[model samples]
Target: MVSIIFVDESFRSGRVCWIKDIVVAVTAENMEAMRSIIQRYRHKRISLAEAGATRHRSIFNGLKALAEDQPDVVIIHDAVRPFVEEDILLRVVTAAKEHGAAGAIRPLVSTVISPSADGCLEHSLDRAKHRASEMPQAFLFDVIYKAYQQCSDYDFEFGTECLQLALKYSHTKAKLVEGPPDLWKVTYKRDLLAARSVIKEKISQEICVVMNTKDEESAGHLLKEVLKKELNCVNVTSTVLDHTGGNVQKFPTDQCYSFICVNVVSSEFQETQKFLSTLEESGLPLLYPVVVVLVHCCDLTLAPLASKMESLMWIRSLAEDMKKRNVLLSGLLLNYSKDEQKLQESFQQGASIIAALVKERSSALAGQLLLA
Candidate 1:
């Protein structure tokens, strides 16, 4: 599939002239994977040299190679504006592919004036006619590469503008897009504060892991403990359909299903026993079939949990909960870890289990899992 090319240029320009570095990074090929990696380490600053490539040549070459072989829609951007939104990228690239040239621009804040001798301004142009060209400039591979292919060192080194290059050589008139306020470049120290604020707002929305907890003798602390190290897992007292909206995106399913429960806590596990009991007593709609994993740790001796109280304390408790006929158990898991990677496996196991159950009982995997 043709994907958007994320272009990031790091240059010590404008007021911050003390730094001496001009880097152009082009991320393409398996765009989603690259993006996921970026989001995973958003706070971390990654350098091209660490990836085994030193210069901007390697970065540009990597992008060019991917472009020639893959032939995908490319969106070139500047690292000065680190707070670029995905919507703007999508809009610009989508238009660029259709029109051959598309670039984002903002209103000129200061008047462009020319100074002759002293520190006095001589001439100034109408700010209305001119606009401050910003990042997130997008163009098709053939259109952009062609411009770079037939260019000089000035165009590659001193000439840092992407949109101007495309227009200067290819005679391609760029579709100047009015960018959002967040598109402002991080030129001065004040711009960095603005960037930080924008980034903070972007991450304010929490990623919630909603699970059902009906344990009577449990305070819902241990489960939260395991998840606290990885994610924000909130255990709902029951399946409350009234709780809607907020980041409530779900997988395709017809029924209302919430919660990931582990029924096979050893007999001594009060949380497991009471949770099953509470689930049986709670009267809720089974909008979607739920995912339940029967888990028991192998490393730690869980024989005390399973055999100390009774041979079938955990199994009978789940069976009793099943009698409620509220929701269906979709999947089963024997063991799991609190590790981040292991958490994904557990989620997948539960998702697959719910997918099968939904398919068997209802519309089947129609809206089972929620998108992050």
Candidate 2:
């Protein structure tokens, strides 16, 4: 129910048209960037505001824009730093509520030096004693509003820091929360690429279920029911591969980026293997990072060591090949049970694994074996 106001600004150069295109793609079919997200997700509590010419002016305008709404706290974050996490947001908001002001900080990665008029370094400051102030700074609504109102025009036009404004006007010492390195801002073309990649990982929600089980009807029905309830705004489809594997043609392989291969046992990986081939032939991985999950439902008590080893070898081989093309491959061995109680537990666990794979978006899990 928390509200977010995404501040927008004009880029100085036309070379960065891609940034505008990315924003347009993300906020299409809605009012503004923040409003689009709020409406798409049916979040009634959030709102948006047009940014001002300068950073200080934008924050001041944002606070004034939300004044009538009477938000308990207002968070001012830079749009360039897109890696801000929800936990860090919570920490800042909580601290702001308690201390009137709070901000994220990281250890200075480089030494700070004072330069003389001749542009030579005069002295160096101890890096250990200093910290870099980062975005996602929060303040009690009244505190920031009053600070902005009492500020001088020179400070408003030239100041780059918000913590200093709060300290100068309201005498509020901001609580500093240690933040991770991913909070780094996007300042160059390479940084923009990294930011876009992070955004893709967070926003990708479509998942495909490749059913290779003998009881395709039952397996597909159970997975659909669980996924529909567990994942939010997820587009899930089940593809049933016939004995000849030609039925795979019916799958909308290009529409979905994540795939889950469901099989009754390790040896039945042929169908899943076939689907992986289909993916490679389509060349989707080269355009976007693809995630492939192999879920093997088996009665481990009845499975022999030889079959398990064979499956592991196959998984490893496929994973190695796919990794080269930006396709992440992971496997889960689930103990199948017919009893209603055990079966329910397994279904939940399996659904969780699929959800985690799609959400994490990291290749570290590739070639890893998981027990569900």
lDDT, candidate 1, equals 0.48
* Residue 186 in candidate 2, Cα distance off native in Å: 0.9
TM-score of each: 0.46, 0.54
Tens digit per residue, CA lDDT, model 2, 110-202: 999999999998999999999999977888878888999998989878999899999999899999999888779889999987877676655
lDDT of 1 by residue, 58-151 (tens): 3355355455354545555556666677667767777787778898888998999989898798999999999888877777767777777776
* Model 1, total clashes: 24
Best-fitting candidate, scored by lDDT: 2
lDDT of 2: 0.71
**C-alpha lDDT (0 to 100) for residue 356 of candidate 1:** 36
